[model samples]
Target: MTTIAVTAPHAPSYYAASGLPQPARPALAGAVQADVCIVGGGYTGLSSALHLAEAGFKVVLLEASQVGWGASGRNGGQLVHSYSRDLDVIEARHGAAVARSLGSMAFEGAAIIRERIERYGIDCHFRPGSMFAALNERQVRQLEHHQALWQRHGHRELELLDAAQTARHIGSGRYKASLLDRSAGHVHPLRLAQGEAMAFESLGGVIHEASPVVRIERGDPAVVHTAAGQVRARFVIVAGNAYLGGLEPQLSGRSMPCGTQVIATEPLGERFPELMPTGHCVEDSNFLLDYFRLSADRRLLYGGGVIYGARDPAHIESIIRPKLERTFPQLRGVRIDYAWTGNFLLTLSRLPQVGRLAPNVYYSQGCSGHGVTFTHLIGRVLSEVIRGQAGRFDAFAGLPHLPFPGGRLLRVPFTALGAVYYDLRDRLGL
Candidate 1:
């Protein structure tokens, strides 16, 4: 319900301060035509635009603010694979075939990212390796099953680490065990977004920043309208996850925007190795997780906790600093150089909602808390669907999406109550 302003500036986070320089792109000022028009300039839109343009489609991307101004720019920057709900959950809910289809493409997004980075020479400080740390025995057993599940889906670049082994990669004794995914990694999220934008433009795609789409006039050639101008295109892709307000009532109802806070410590310098020795990104295995990694400059960037209604916390540092220090007591009074919050769309099933708004109007949203890699895969699937290859897209589109039981009014409280139960379980190590 908290709509992002059209002219909003990027959050004052470490990524914004240290990201690659991107020139201001002009907003839409007049009517234009393209083969495809994309709403939102985050990963989804950028990937779709870049892929479509490479496939020889005239693509126009419209962003409410600047590219990556939303959660795409402000996330933990970990290149985590799969959906927020995981493949085992998908199988339990939707059956094996559905899980198999999704699992096949689970690692493709990270692959797409590496491919693009190499092809376009993106300088986002790409590092390859991510660890899912477990805090208790129960979580460790779950991770063991997790490794099997991923391996069943053909993902082989994984290693299960005991506590002693985990200590080598992660400098803390907080975790009981970990699962290291060599194929997974981290990056400067904002820089990656900007680099993708540059790649899209290099392929002759058009981007209009600060052009918040007012509405879409669905037709054979859909018209995406903004305050200053409009884009008439053969197809339209709605890639605005949480920042997408009431532009589409259908999308707004099934998903809720949840805010997560992150804080960056001052450069750790020599102490960086004392923290994360292997330089891999790490996220703990808790119901409400804590994720952290070393930045290119060796700063410890950490994030945790979720606000159900996307409300900015009164003090972000107060919320995140406690968790950061709890994980690493050595930095008890460490100065937090930057603290910020960003919203990601959370669906009832904690799975992404991918389907069509109309015959020519496509959409992908509700990445839950797993957008970094999934968004890229969704973009490619969207492009494939538009190119008359809807098999993969249909696999995702067929996933059932249900609105929250209480709908918009009480959805926040309902979800918060559920989160409380899970958090309690996490605390009890049940």
Candidate 2:
């Protein structure tokens, strides 16, 4: 119901600075008809457009900015499997049937990413492993349980490492142990996003950058309107996620946008191996966690902390530098070349919200912080649902989404209070 202007340029992050060169796409200027019209240009929209186009559908994708301009281009780039909340939590909250259904698709996202990189020859600096670093025994136990839970869900590529083993992989002494996922990895997120956009266009999908949808008129064929033009399509896919703004009231209440920040150090050159010998991306096992990896040029790309209301912190480096130093004290005075923030949609359930606004209007959002891989999977699922295969899509859509306890005005403070409590618990090793 509320229309927000989409005027911001891409964040000046490392990804944006070094991303693949892409041509500027013109904004939608005239009426267009298509089999499907997709909102947003991030991973979800790009993936849906690519998949649907491949399926022989005439697809037109509308971007508020350039492709990968949102979180899709700005994420940590770690290929973390599963959703924000793990399958164990899903099984406990919902039933095993729901968990099983969701679990079957858990690792599929990462697989889809790898397949795309290979099939499209996307040079996104694809690496092949991720580590879950454990700072205390409690976290180590959690990682152990995490490994077991993933194994139960048919993910057998995990290996638990003792402190000594972990030391070999990560030069830091901060972690007590770690769990390595061979199948999980990292990539140049922005490059990957640009590549996906290219792939989508290559399949005859139309893309309009700087075209933000102002409203949707539901009918036999949905009408999506922007400032310059409108799209009439049989089906409309809303993949905007955190940047979706106030376009749909149905989705606005159930989720909140939260910002996360990252900083990239000047390329580590010869010292890279001393920090990450195996080139594995790592995320610690704390509720509010730190994830870092070696970038293609060997710079340490470290990210952590969350801003509940998606507000950019004044000094991103001030917030993250301490954590980075704590992990590797040797890099205490390392010069940071870039620092930036991006927002991700957070649902109360910590699972994605997927369903229909109307019979012909479908949406998928709220990946919380674990969207890099899941968004791609959801895109494919959205295409599947459009193409008459709704089983997998139904499984995700069936999950219940509860609104935040506090109303819009109070949600941010309330969530921040809760995060502080959990952070303290994490410090106390409870």
Q: How many times do residue backbones clash in model 2?
A: 0
List TM-scores for all candidates, in order: 0.98, 0.98
TM-score of 1: 0.98
Clash total of candidate 1: 0
What tens-digit string does per-residue lDDT give for candidate 2 at 216-312?
9999899999987899999999988998898997798889999999999998888746789899999998899999999988999999999998998
CA displacement after TM-score superposition, residue 90 of candidate 1 (Å): 1.1
For every candidate structure, what is the RMSD over all alpha carbons to the true structure, in angstroms? 2.5, 2.2
Query: How much is 286 displaced in model 2, in angstroms?
Result: 0.5
Candidate 2: where are CA atoms >4 Å away? 1-8
Q: Which stretches of model 1 miss by more than 4 angstroms?
A: 1-6
> How do the residues 259-369 of candidate 1 rate in per-residue lDDT, one tens digit apiece?
999999998788645788888999999999999999999889999999998999979999988899888988999988999999999999999999999999999999999
